[model samples]
Target: MQNASHRIRVYQASDCPELTRLDVSKLGRAYHKIPKIISTKFDSIEARLGIFFLKKYRLNALLSNLTFDIDYHCKNAQIFSTPYGSIGFDINRKFLLSILHTYYGLSKEGNTVSLDLTQSVTKTEDRLKIKLGQELLQLTMVKEVLNETLELKNDYTSIIHQWPYSVRFWLEGYDEYCFSILLDAHHVDLLLATSRVDSESDEPKAKNLSSEQIEHMFNNMPLTLTGRLVSINLTVAQLLNIGPGDIIPVSLNEPLPVFIENEQIFSSVVAEERGRLYLSEFNDKTPEMKYE
Candidate 1:
């Protein structure tokens, strides 16, 4: 690779414009769009579905990183029996959460509610719609399911390449809380690429053509040499037992995760001065950034 950077050029256009289903053309046909509404509660949906159980997000991130103009649905989330015990996973996030939309249709509007500094205002289904572009943003999180080889990027990519499938979704057209993974893949890809400069010959590109002056632009970021986030989240009971002593659990250790688009590009340490929080930075420059 040029300057020890991964220069990516591949792109993926999802099978259907309607993201309620998996494009099983790559991952195989065994996967299908089977959405099941929790119907119970929305609190920590990803926790119940299990995201902290995921071992890694590299391949999933790569699959997602390469494309931007499609829709994917995280339809079926389940736990499977394995020798290692019950393994649960979203199994479809590569197509869903990875491909996001900047714009969407907003349904029910929300009213402003007042809150107190010390008042406990939590675990509420704040059913509010925020207009994006062609689609509306709904409650979303990276869900997980039981899996064995999830840590291996290639095995995952191989399975995804051969049998790409979509999930069953309850889209946002009619309802707001109901979810789907509809996205402007083209736009997403364009933006992700814009974050990186491929080569010295790379054209003057970017949505605003002002990467040269972006305030957030950095020559490098911390590298995620080796790490993972595991089982986490506090139950209401755990949150309710507050009158006495308590300890909240977290999957992240010293170095928390960093990403351009939630892609887990690095692990960083958090610091604070008086009250405000800060993150320690390191070097992990992508190709385009190097040329710049």
Candidate 2:
């Protein structure tokens, strides 16, 4: 009797591009400043509306002391679109309610105000969600820092595909209301690009160094040089049959391939110096090179 063959599928944390540890570290550093930037922006708003005017008009509902944190996972995160890609996040419903209650002068001291999770959001609450989302996106410089052409997503959906990175943001005193944001690798790239540009601008202007000095500086920098001796292609059966100390015959092609950081640059021939082996006779083509 013949047996049926089946392939097994692998599951991963997300469908998006995988972030390396270095990428995660850079993103954490970049996002750490968000809360302070937002806080300053909020303070400016209050300053614009003088203390006397705010006291007299009773218009002091401005958001403050908000914090941004990193979240590795997310649930029920709302999806929004940007020029580069989509962003997913969900604010804590209770926190939203608290903000609304505070603005409307409602008592949130006890069970007097509690939201029913099963109940659908009212029109007022929906509007507030949209408004606040837009405001926060702007304050976080999602547009101003990345791209001015970027627009806040008006309509949002909780059903979204998993993204690689997430951030939890909330009002400092309202820890229960913390919201988590989900973003993919593209957004992180844009952020890092902006960050790089800013850092370059802030760096002291370069001094006038001669060509020789510049050459010397670069020559001192360490770089890895790689050489490929040969490559072998094998079928699964051939690979499975291999055993320890198995000698696989490989022919050396003239002017073997050379690489810089794993990228093929040129090819060179193997030569012997006084006491050491070296590469010489550089060329663009080799005898084993196949054209298709």
Candidate 3:
């Protein structure tokens, strides 16, 4: 059942109009590392599996025939239900028998394992199926992604009639084995969103510039410098009574304050040569007072 507000987008080409479904091609374009992720995880699964499997033999699972399908279904599919959703794996009897043969340390040269597809599944095969499914979920970190804390339920019936989307690939090392991972729109959306978030978070953030670097950058900029030779305090009456041809006596013996605009930064002494007054003896070691 769908909500009343839900709308279905229709696709049109030429003169014909068609109903649009899940666009898996868009997903393919968005994420191309799905195959690599599966292959890498599958290849290294044996290492993280267990001491018995590690000390005995490595499965060395290799991925091939990677594909994405919409509206996929499989008969005799073993499903494991989690809190978030359900995942399923489908393997034929022949493939299961091959895996069983490999599990028991049987040599492929001398060992003759029966490959009857019609044979009923045994208890041992069921256990192996559960173990392999659980291992796949763990190695791929699907459980962690879904935040599934409870153990997967096998006996429980899944609400999903047919998987909306599925990832089908072949695991080839010992023998060619077809593997199907059933997923729905929710799972696809979640995984894609998570990937995007991780990629965004992994990007390098802006770093703070050092004091020396900041100072070096600011030093390169052009600034206005003003020189103050002397300061004379005048009364309001003297300023108003000043007339033409009036001379104000001033001294140039002390060091004059140098300014960048109104802000004084250093001091310099007055020097006169050839009837021209100039500033000399720069000193910026100590802070200077503001020129009023």
Candidate 4:
């Protein structure tokens, strides 16, 4: 029997960039390219009538025009175990009604679209999932229409095969809706890893100080001192006669003045312990005598 060879693959977090927070402003700019208004006069008339009805019902005017954008803040966003990335959009109910009225020509005054006047419109998780599915379907339909019209399958299949990685929808002239394209496990892993790398790169690094900088920082630091004091009155003739072996008598009980940079700082008693000189009994008092 022959031994079989096997190959192993390794994955690292550093291989990917940090998952960046979605920029709503940039998404809004991209969404402006989409044609939202087919007929300006029809859209303007419908929008004006909608605005009048909204004010009559005391509804918020979030969407001023037929192609107006909605403001959305993303929260509780997570990459699911499945292929889809789940995100919650914080939006008002008036905004939802506005969308229905503008796009689908749904009446705002009907019992079918009844909304609580006191409570604001909020999308639940289930509702969001449903909305996401609908949006995905719409996107697919749009892509199909584009392909058919442009004859992309036969002519530009090589150039435009892959769906965009992400799509953003404008809400009240702002980027609000972000849809992440379904990705395979391998691609998802790479995206997350890249996000991590990007995040790590944004952090500030600790810089090392140079030798000169270190020296400059420590130059003004105070130093410890161990000092002694002695006084002797001697004539010029006596000082001239003094030799290396000459013994000058001085008081042993007197405290020595300790100095820090030529300034008398404190006084301490000099003592001997086991043939080693030691400073003891330190006090704030300075010596009465002064050096010339």
Candidate 5:
């Protein structure tokens, strides 16, 4: 005989008045807040799952009279013995049959199909396993279903595999026909891998100067030159007695020295044209006399 000590009485929607009136509107505004109200008395299991499936896949999955039971296991070499929960739902059999019919081109007459459940392991060996189940095996196609359900080509397998925890989904209101997957610590790391933002360096890089910028810098530069060949040493009385039309004699043969920015760079001969002084016969000659 089977052990009755392990069996626990589970309640249905008809047995509870609060479960019958549950609706999706009772959930809070944020999608992340639904996890807190999942096991509350105000909302039914089916209602919470319906909202979750709808928001995640945008599919109108019909779930009815959902219920879950906690199962405790002993420590084993292959599986972790932590206490975990399993939830069952009466799925719309026709909707599930239609998906298999459209994709794999399988007949819609059968009520069940085989599925593979892969679990990520976090032991020192870094190993994992894939198990087979009858009805629950169809969950392997969940990524494909999500893509078809949303009418897009997005690959959602990577997103679904990031959940590092235990979650079980049962269909046809039967515990024997269920799909289950476990995500260990390694799987959680994959989900949080992209959370950190990379920091940028504060130092500026060298920029190449454009032609316009070089032209602007050259146009703003000032150029100065002084044309003086000799300085006449005059006493204070000779400078004060000087008047207009006074001719101070000097040697015209001496070349005028041109100082650019107070530096003697070139020497030029002095020339007169139309009573205006001009520099002519320029030569690269350093002046021997220094300017004070």
Candidate 6:
């Protein structure tokens, strides 16, 4: 299931004694000193999704019946700035990726979500709505919907996947852009294969796309053996430290020492004539593999 548990907060009069003793400013200022704040931070998703939910099922109070959860929002969300970036949520609160130069953190350019539209997300959406029914109902009852389609920092597409299509939207060009959305809080728990936030070498782009696009590329791409290890990179400092002509030794000394991940594959020797490399006798057992 979606795993969205509803929280029924029936507001009763606060303890007058406690209120009189505690300073409102100390409690971060009194919000809803009246009774309660229903659903303010993010507009209750009822209006946009209410009719569909109500007709598809039951009934409830008017649209305005839903109230904003003022306290939770005012407290949980904050004004944040980092070397990565800066963001502010003037209204409800949005998040962003602070890709600050020289800062130690994940860059906004990397770490993106791929939308597999080929996989249907209707099931996921339904489960999410069901699990977080109150939230959806709140939206409907309040005649408001969460702004799901905020500006995607990177390229993005909308598709229905297996279910619980959750993603952390990292906004760069925009402020208060970082936030997460998916089927249910649970599905995000069982995430399948995940790409690194930063694929230092080669990484695919597209925060979203449909099934056909994913499938089309998945099927057409050549299955290049990933075990191939072409080079080992070292910093300039390591090279400059070499005195005279120090022999920087490597592990495998086989003639065909090409490494597929760890295992040794086609073996070749380093032959430099005009500052270029030539591999000879690659995987050659009987004969020496030579370069052209």
TM-score per candidate, chains pooled: 0.17, 0.47, 0.49, 0.22, 0.22, 0.17
Model 2: residue 136 alpha-carbon error in angstroms? 0.7
Off by over 4 Å in 4: 1-222, 243-246, 286-292
Ranking by lDDT: 3, 2, 4, 5, 6, 1
1-292: candidate 6 lDDT, tens digit per residue: 5898899977666733333233232242233231122233223333443353345433221223322222122222222222222112222121111211112223336655443335443443433323333333223211222222222121113222222122222322444333333222221121111111222227666679789988997986643222222445578999779888687765534343565565554566655556655555455334557999
Per-residue lDDT of candidate 4, residues 1-292 (tens digit) = 9999999988698987444343332332332322232122334433543464355434333332223222333332222222232212223334444444444445544636554547543455335444534343223312221211111111111222222233232224434422323322233334344444555679875498789878986995547684856766789999899899888887554778777768778888888877767778999974479789
Q: What is the lDDT of residue 78 in candidate 5?
A: 26
Candidate 1, residue 253: the lDDT equals 53
Q: Give the alpha carbon lDDT tens digit for every residue of 124-231 in model 5.
A: 112211111212222321221111111112121322222223334444444343334343333223212212111112445338878997899799665676898566
lDDT at 155, model 2 = 39
Model 3 pairs whose backbones collide: none
Predict model 3's lDDT versus the native.
0.63
Model 3 per-residue lDDT at 221: 67
lDDT by candidate, in order shown? 0.31, 0.61, 0.63, 0.43, 0.39, 0.34
Model 5: residue 229 alpha-carbon error in angstroms: 6.2
Global CA lDDT computed for model 4: 0.43
Where does candidate 6 have its weakest 10-residue lDDT segment?
187-196
**Candidate 1 per-residue C-alpha lDDT over 223-251 given as tens digits, one digit per residue, 9 for 90 to 100:** 43433434466789867786755665565
- Say which candidate scores most in TM-score: 3
What residue runs in model 6 are displaced by over 4 Å at the alpha carbon? 1-130, 133-221, 227-292
Model 3: runs farther than 4 Å from truth?
1-60, 106-109, 141-151, 159-161, 173-175, 204-292
**How many Å off is the CA of 218 in candidate 3?**
41
